[model samples]
Target: MLMVALCGAVAGFVLLGHSWLQLLIAGALGIIFTQFAFLAHEAAHRQIFAKGTTNDRYGRILGTAFVGISYSWWMNKHSRHHANPNRVGKDPDIEGEALAFYEEKAVPRTGLRAIIARKQGYLFFPMLILEGLNLHYASVKSLVTRSEKPTKGRFVEIGMLAGRFALYLGAVFWVLPVGMAFAFLGVQLAIFGLYMGASFAPNHKGMPIIPAEVKLDFFSRQVRTSRNIAGRFWPTVLMGGLNYQVEHHLFPSMARPHLARARLLVRQHCQDHDVPYTEVSLASSYGTVVSYLNRVGLAARDPFACPVASQLGRR
Candidate 1:
């Protein structure tokens, strides 16, 4: 991990100064940044170390300094998402502050939002094009304006994030021609965004939503609400061990190396308890997500298609 980060930084510094290499470097840099992001994610979950603070150190350094995201902000938000996976009011993932991932979140929409809500399934992948920038913006905001009780390292994190971007922006603007710099920056951020979302959305996007009032046991809730991508090799490596979503949710701190084995045991446990275990190919999982979104989208305009409405009627 250190070696990868080092190589990325060294190569990025060298290439950023060369106008001719900016385009190629931008694409490679995006992948490198994403790899750091995956490692930072592991650190956030305490998977990289036995001690919590030690892991936080790794997370703060890797996520902020390298990925230009505030670790404290991410940790706080992600912790909530874990505690209440898809719980309607509690899970930030479906809160739809910017984009509506669920039916309830789409209500009260107007004009452009309403139009987009109707075609959200088609726009899901496209929207992820900006996720990288969105995450960075949110992370910085969380520190300056949004933190409840600011974590210990938040101020330092702010500095690191700002400094990281300063160097990145400075290099691109100073070293390359104006048009090429924009192209380089755009490509890097776009790939970073798409890679970030594509790798995680399939894990739980179309899974069962847990209503706010419903109570569930830990194991059952995690299994029922999460979907696992079934494969080895590329799936395991590409997803940064997150393709084992059920196991990761169940044991979020378990090392990435152990998730494959844990998945087998967790699957068997779910079977023993008759819990639903949804595992599908990566492509199929996306299909399920699109279908699910389209169903909810249609529900917005057609009462007959609203599953929630049908349930309310029975009551």
Candidate 2:
């Protein structure tokens, strides 16, 4: 709450100041929005409240209104991800798009898309510069395309998103020159996207990609597929408890404050069960993700090769 208040105050002051240099505050606001997004994510998981309805209410407000993302869209997609992390054909996170998490997804790529797939690891961070825009676009797209489905708070989210963008864009245009306003918005979105991608990409990207047909117990599925960033204070604060991703996956409803202790318990349990528990430094995890993506990209370079061979190479 204090941070929220501080962010609003600083943003208000900076907007009224009319200084180009104050665009830096826009970058800071991006980081702040990502923090709110994390809170929204937790709320959606029912970690912030006892009742599911209460959590949904707050999740909608924080995600759609404050963070300019659709709670309904995120909830549906993220729930699927939690239910099947890194599982082929099941986990939406690993679904083939611009970047392929699994090798087979890369095999059919051609032309520029193939080029991107081949070097996606190196371009991942740069690609994330558009993630903020992508999130907003995807949220609205989900709502529009899935209108026939019964979505809780669908119209309400649309209204909130409309209002949120109205006020945000209104303020930006009102306070700054047209050119500067665009630049300011660009910086904010870029930073928000980059930070979000950086925090999330390390969690499961380099970890095992489970076959869709393979059935695993909950403990094994969550523990083996997730990787933890080794840290206590700063990582927890910066990543919004995402650094404790292994523990987070095991206990989706676990509150941020308890994740650290949960990590120890989860790690010991994994050790006892002889399950692979991955914990690496933040830097090391990033390198692993990049290397992993590059290896998957190799499939695009050789389209005729056996997919089984590529899968074997991945292991």
Candidate 3:
């Protein structure tokens, strides 16, 4: 993790020095950092090393320095997300102010709110970025106002988050020239924005947002709750193989590089077992999401209210 962070920093410094190289280096390093983010995620789930402690320790270090996130917070929150994905009232994954899934009770039905609700998907990208920051702020607030004693790991996570933020500030204000600093920040922001946008949209959106009343088996839930993108090599590399959303959700322990193979394996298993599986090409899947967003602004509605087996069906 230290080595990866150092390499990223050196690449970033080179990007700062050369104006023309900014975009190339930024894109490259952004991909590197994005991959590191996945590694941190894997570690948080104790999927990286044989020992849970080692996995957590590595996750914390890499998450703080390379990804600028706290692993402990991620683990706690993400566990909840996985446990209750798309459950409107229960899932923390619906932390974004712009809710994407509709619940019968929470439906908005008037004037501007109605308009926003109708076109909710279009605003999802910006909302996602805001929600990421919101999550950080909310976590810190929770930590400070807690009446009960915090755990040692929680304190360590908070401290690491603070340090990472400080380092980011220092890099922007003190380490580099104004222009260079802004460039670096811009690059980081681009990466952050892209990461959130690309990785999230396909997982649950455009799928049936079921009510808690719907009793789904484990395999059914896994298949229904996620979509798979048959992305080619370049896109897979750029997105850190997150395009294989269904496979990742099912086996979060597997490394990103192995997702495609896992997807194939899962597909064959599902076929043999007579289980339903959803797969769409990358372009079509992304297009479905965009079209949905264009139709629904920021309000919670079931994207898969009308399910189409293929992208053409959506059209």
Candidate 4:
């Protein structure tokens, strides 16, 4: 069913050809594809399908088709994120940790590259471009450079990457006229950037950056380490169900369709258990993220300083 929806949407965009209307349609479908990717994420976690090989099979099929990312990569890294949350040096999800905390850092006696790295997260739209590049780079580097032998999962990823390249080439040469192809790619990239930025911005940015040394309890870790955003259906759908990030971090096995219910349950449990639960309207959450980014951008000459090192420097 998900595959059919993605195919129909991609085909619809292809058939429309290169008008402004075609671009609009392609953008809409791109958003739909992003939503499908989220569902694939749920499947990867065995939240959608029965928890077994069936879930793995379905997740790979649906996820790779909608997005170039592999289920293997997501499972390996994303699970680590949930396990460790925001443990500074330990979390794979922490993109250049030091760079993310520029606002609190002291003056740096360092290279010009360091300064740019600190403020890199706030360049906003461009970061999406960097993220796409980072995805490709990381995948390739992992494949070629990993010390361990390639597993079946890695082989599957190789196949998926090849398939993605073929489909992209086919779209360029055979599916549509050159102009229409360019337009399709442009709209798709724009939607991709928007999706990446919006989905991730609220996750951890302004939240207190924990040092590697801090030992936190489970509920305190979750409340302080994660954030939730409030958005209408459009943003939620566009973000592929990630708007309920707090629920996701807690119960990653729940399907996105069930996240709202899960959020209520988690809130109730927190109340009963006396856990410190954090809640913010979606608008305010996103606002907090933006404000943090702006402050980090305007403050330190180098925003990318390692939080631990910077804290020690302050002392």
Candidate 2 lDDT over residue span 245-265, tens digit each: 988988999999999988888
Top-scoring candidate (TM-score)? 2
230 in model 2: Cα distance from truth in Å?
0.3
* Candidate 2 stretches greater than 4 Å from native: 2-16, 302-315
Q: Residue-wise lDDT of candidate 3 within 105-176, one digit each (tens)?
A: 225545555556666656556555454455456656655565565544767767777887787667555756
Clashing pairs in 2: none
Worst 10 residues of 1 by lDDT: 297-306
Ranking by TM-score: 2, 1, 4, 3
Residue 237, model 3, lDDT:
62
After superposing candidate 3 on the true structure, give the runs of residues whose Cα lies further than 4 Å from its correct spot: 1-30, 103-106, 109-113, 126-132, 135-139, 145-152, 177-187, 272-274, 293-315
lDDT of 1: 0.83
Show the colliding residue pairs in model 1: none
Better of 1 and 3 by TM-score: 1
Q: Give, for candidate 4, the lowest lDDT window spanning 10 residues.
A: 101-110
Candidate 3: Cα lDDT at 85:
70
What is the TM-score (0 to 1) of candidate 2?
A: 0.93
Instruction: Give the candidate number with the greatest lDDT.
Output: 2
Cα lDDT computed for each candidate against the true fold: 0.83, 0.88, 0.65, 0.67
- Quote model 1's TM-score: 0.91
Which is superior by lDDT, 1 or 2?
Answer: 2
lDDT of 4 by residue, 1-67 (tens): 6557767766776676555576766666556656666777778777877766988887877666457
Model 1: residues >4 Å from true position, as ranges?
5-21, 146-148, 302-315
